[model samples]
Target: MDKNTIIGILLIGAVIIGFSIYNQPSEEQIKAQQELLAKQEADKKKAVEQQKAAQKKQEEIKKQTLEDTTALFHQALTGSAENIVLKNDKLELTINSKGGTVTKAVIKDYKSLDGAKDVTLFDEKDQSLSFKIDGKEQNINTEELFFSASEKTDSTVTLTATAGAGKTLTMRYLLGKDYMLHFSLQAQGMEGVFSSKTNAVNVEWNERCRQQEKGFTFENRYATLTYKEKDGGTDYLSETSEKIDERISETLDWIAFKNQFFSAMMIAKNDFAPNASLTSIPQQKESGYLKEYKARVETFFDPTGKTPTELEFFFGPNDFRLLQAMEKESKFGKDLKMERLVYLGWPLFRIINRWFTLYVFDWLTNLGLNMGIVLILITLLLKAITYPLVKKSYMSSAKMRVLKPKLDEATKQYDKPEDQMQKQQAMMQMYAQYGVSPLSGCLPMVIQMPIWIAMFNFVPNAIQLRGESFLWIEDLSTYDPIAEWGTNIWMIGDHLSLTCILFCGANLLYSWMTMRQQRDQMVGAQAQQMKMMQWMMFLMPLMFFFIFNDYSAGLNFYYFVSLFFSAAIMWALRKTTNDEKLLKALEARYQENKNNPKKVGGLAARLEAMQKQQQEMQRKREELERKRKGV
Candidate 1:
């Protein structure tokens, strides 16, 4: 039994060993495994070598690029910048190659504030323009890099600069016969030079506006920032504010720094980026500068440097007709609506000025009449147009005057406070009987107030009146100084205007004449109050004399002429009106109203309703008093 068991065990063990040997890997398989391990080691070493070589190559490339940039910047900074001059009939521009900026601009047809020299809109010390461009590894400011200038003519110039290898930046300017100048900026082969992170080119423009007019305060009031949005309306900064900082969220068409009579405007062809910003700061009175303006704008710049940007600049006077023609002609390929820069007034007054006053003034100007005479004619036309209202106002006053005697008699019959309501009722009845309304005179004057305010705003801002001479005045736009006190005074300026004096004198005379008529009509405390008010009215003209002493001579003259005309018209009306006849007619009207009370529903019905309301209110008050007194 042991032998058989042992043999079986040995056989099983040999079979198991043979199976294990058969399942074991062959020599070829072992050789293949070793070869694969060797190949993997070799491949890992090759990969490391490749990485090192690539890193070294990249370092070399970066070093070379840094060197090239340094050399280019050195060249740009070392060279002496040149300048090119361009001129036209209206302007002279001096362009510098350093920043490719307009260093100086002279207006040919304008004079300095003192009128002693030709006007310079801006000089090198007053302006700065720069462009910030994103570079591959750094940012570049064009203002610090010198540019090479070529292709200069009487009205055109070109400036160019090399940004990097196969890359260039260029600027061109073309002056026109008028007050406009065309500008263009271009970049070429800048795919590798500029960064791909953004698609905007940042621009900065700074300017300190110079004073070009005789009056600083007057001109400063008109200085402001005006901008037009693309596909939208125009807007402006607050002219009366001290400082302004505006961030535009809409695409912009143009930007302007407008002074009183002149402006410097920049127009973009393709529109500015939506995130542009503008700032304005007014200079102090002692600074001699009109204002300080700063603009930070972004424009589209092709990352691949294929497209160019075009712009236009206007440096000229703020003439209404000229701006209108520019808008009509579409000089910028779109209506710029530049005429809106003129501060005519609000919508209603603006319409009046645009459709009526401006046209009439132009017509008179075309006739070669003096500005003073033109204003006189305008006043006469206005008076003629409003004559009917004036006549009605006078007739109402006359009717009121006719009823004064009867009103006094009625009022004298009631001397107690309890009878005050009854006395007022009687007076109202008398007025109704005479067919007179207290509001009639006041309403006509209220209707004419807009015209007066329009004229007040228009005359001071009229560019046509500037430097115009008439009579003893040399400039109708400024105070016609007849005397100088040699010292500045509050409210009253150092100089006294003859036109202001004449205006105040005429106003006082008008007030006296009107107060005389009112004194004759009023009685008791009313008369006393009116007498005090008449003195106050005289003081009003004196106050006006102080306030308007520094105002425009044309405005003062217009007011004086208007008051003169009013006094004359009022005097003539007083002379023609017959008091006795008016009283008789009022009596007849009273009888007729009594006979047909239902048909007299105009003023009498309103008075009757008012009387009833007063009586009811008095009754309620008396009832409340009785309840409180337990009577």
Candidate 2:
């Protein structure tokens, strides 16, 4: 072997020896590894045994739980349910033995939207209510259990659920002569049957509200789930396809499933717990229902049966004046604010109706005139009160109309775009000379807008107009179908309304007259803008015909009558106005303005400042152009 090969072999052997020494395990490490493997095997076996034992324990617990729940309430769980009737002057209630629930409610001597049948506010298929008892052995579900009912009186009943060892839960109901039903629940010989940790019981209320009116769209828009929180303002679920409210962090005094014209309200004297949930789900139009409303709430419970939970159920029409009188006469309803269920509108319009229109309407109704005549009188009264403002607005427009010749001559003088600033300046000067304020015409109309919108909210919600008919109208609260095809169509609905057509016709005539008066005043770009506005205004009445076809006859009648009165007033003012005399007065005022320039003030002053600024800017632009061209 060569010398280099021999050295390389020795080096390789030494490196292998060093690596073996570095990685070699000690006796202590080998012992520890074996112990670890043994411990792992032992742990695996212990886990398998524990899992099997836990499963067996769970099975035993479930069997015991079943026995605890079902053994005592055997009779209560197996029987068929029976129903009993409770009648009064204003309401009839059907009580079921199964859940101790009010299965149905009918309003006495009242007709629903159909105008033919007595109003059935709710039936067994539409609503159900139940209580879940929190007990010691098990959380008892009372909904599926039966109770033995006893007749206490003509308007009162007692339903009792008895278990083994003579323990019992009893529910009692008393129907008042009015629309309210008093309810209470108590326990007897059930000392150890309730859990100590739970202080309240759960209440389940589910309602698929039935359609109460022919106009589903109108009825659904006004219906919602309304509630009043203790020491807080009244609130409600949003009117939409689906909504849920689970954030009620305060005790509540009452909750209501409010329909458009009626409601089924539950008022708790002791108040409900802070934890509650409310849900709203809309139903299909073909289902003959408005929406589905559900509420899961909690109420205070007494384990010892010392005091019973007390509540009152109100079933009646949403009459504003009646509810107001009831509130004044109630012991617990002082703070209830139940009349809010009859919505007026948002704050501004509501104020108008609440403070003015309601009082006038009630007075007119008390006068014993026909409803149609009452509406006409109200329209005439409103027109008379607002005559001064209307006269001033028309006179302003007429002043501009009389100056058309002077305006046309100025238009010819400043026809080019470059003279636009001069034209505006000249127009402002002419308006000042004629002593006219353009916005004077609009401010008065603006002041009258709240009244118009307030009436729109008032007419539909007026319960007094429900069945009152006049002049071939069967019901004023719903649409009067002068022409109905018995088929649903987009935008036009299933009917053509007579009042709606009349209102649109009056509106079109008014629009044409107003446009003719204003068109002569506009020139240049403003004239083009006026033409576009004219088209929009003319189209509005046509669109309103389609939109308002399904609206209540009362609302359409109000609009039609109001428009007819307005057009007549305008014609009267125009006939009384003398254009020649008005023009001579304006000429004299112009000569006076020429002599006394000190009359420049108010909006005219502002316009003068703006006109000067425009002229200065135009002069500077011209000078700049000249400089750029080296002029």
Candidate 3:
């Protein structure tokens, strides 16, 4: 039995034993367990309170650390041996010989579109902000900020921010308002420079790529994302950049720039230098986002007699409508369109996912008797639509199976790798005579990848399945629900996911059946191909087990159903095909045609010639070796 099969059996055994124990739980057992827990809690409460008080004191001490950071800023900005704070907001930032440039810069309350209205100090929605020191007061300008609103749109919200000097930077939450929150940063000051840093932002995503790593990198015309957070575990992602966007001018416009998902950066012409590459700058891990960004920007421009260079900022979700209205790379909204499988196989898959989900899903959701079934119906419909392709693949596999014996004989005759070329030439002639194309089966399977990806993305965030339950599963929208175990463990969660287990079993069965059929036909390079496939059979299911563990149970259920259907189809094919008769017929035909004196030889004649050549080569090579050794 395969390792997976053994593991599967063990898992089943464990579940059965656990179930039996759970059902037989006695009142005395429950009472004893409860008493032990109550005593432990009673003994720990006093020490826990004391520890809590100590933690509170430590938190206060940590809060004071922010002021020390603020002091460092003052010392650098003053350009004085002894740093003196002119006022509370003005702090000196030290950048080495180049003068410590802005370490970080961002607008906090202007964090999201909802928070944009609170950014009142800036005028246009895409407004540019820059600060400079003129004697005692800081010279600030929002003209380059480019704050804007639609000609007449009710989704309008008020934006306010502290400006001038000694003003508290504050923004209030706005209710029942719609606005595009836009933010851009100034990090060119750090470019052509090296430092360790981190950047954090609060952003929400409806659907995200699961495989992206924390340090994922993308480079293109507009900007370069040196790295991105793989698992968006934390609220924000930080990146380091070698180049920065040079266009710091104040002309409000949107253009293509490179981003993690799309290609482009949305910005105005006057806010940054022309042709200057835009890049994400990192900050210290311990630094506060809003406070650090402000301090860094202040420090960035301290050199040119405190010349203030304007900066633009955006804060909001990549809603297509909002992105388009903002005119800052509106394509960020393109995400609302299903796009993962746009280029491969058939573009129709993308169109279907984008259109069907938007139009049909919501309407059909009302009739839901467990969204898992709805998902299955959707998959079945898709399969029906693409039935021709899948049928072609099955037929090809059947044809390959019929030709397996002839292919195997060809390999046996040409045992040496160096003789493979001649062996292939002969094998090709046989295939040509039989009118079989070796690639026919693989082509259709390759074509199905895109449709698979489109479905993978579609199922997870499909709101229809959120609270729905299927048989034995409580929630199709989340993972298969199971009560936790008493023994605590880390990383891996306590409850076992039944859907994931079923999904794996189905995958194993499908893989085993497919592999068994291919094993007989494997030859030379194809044998190596079979080995790789076996590895995939083992690895792929385990990969899905971890990945789908947290995904919608409905998605896993869909996969299980698909695999089961495939297994059934394979069984039907095997039962109907007369393999024994087919093999006998092929062998009889080969024997009858072995010495027909045909030109260029057939598969059987080629095998005879190869075997004779193999014997002669072996004899000659052995004789030559003996002579050289003076034997």
lDDT of 1: 0.80
lDDT of 1 by residue, 1-631 (tens): 2455569879999999999999998999999999999999999999999999967875565455456755434455436878788997778888888988888888776656667545788889998888777777656677877888888899988888876566678888888777788888888876776666757778888999887666566677778888988888888777666554488899998888888777888887777889788888888755777889988998767767577777788777788888876554334687687877777888888888889999999999999999999999999999899888888877887888777877888789776767777777777777776677755656546756788888887887788888888999888887888888766788875788899999999999988987887777664546766755665678989999887887888999999999899899889999999999988988898898888765565564587578979799989999999999999
Show model 1 residue runs off by greater than 4 Å.
1-74, 116-118, 230-233, 248-251, 328-332, 603-608, 621-631
User: lDDT of candidate 3 vs native?
Assistant: 0.43
Candidate 2 regions exceeding 4 Å error are: 1-71, 78-80, 113-117, 164-166, 244-251, 328-334, 610-631
Which candidate comes out best when scored by lDDT?
Answer: 2
Give each model's whole-structure lDDT.
Answer: 0.80, 0.82, 0.43
- Backbone clash tally (model 1): 0
TM-scores for candidates 1 onward, in order: 0.83, 0.83, 0.45
Q: lDDT: which is higher, 2 or 3?
A: 2
lDDT tens readout by residue for model 2, 167-217: 888899988767778899887777688867766778899998888888787
* Poorest stretch of ten by lDDT in candidate 3: 204-213
- The per-candidate count of clashes, in order, stands at 0, 0, 73
lDDT of 3 at 121: 21
> Residue 327 lDDT in model 3?
42
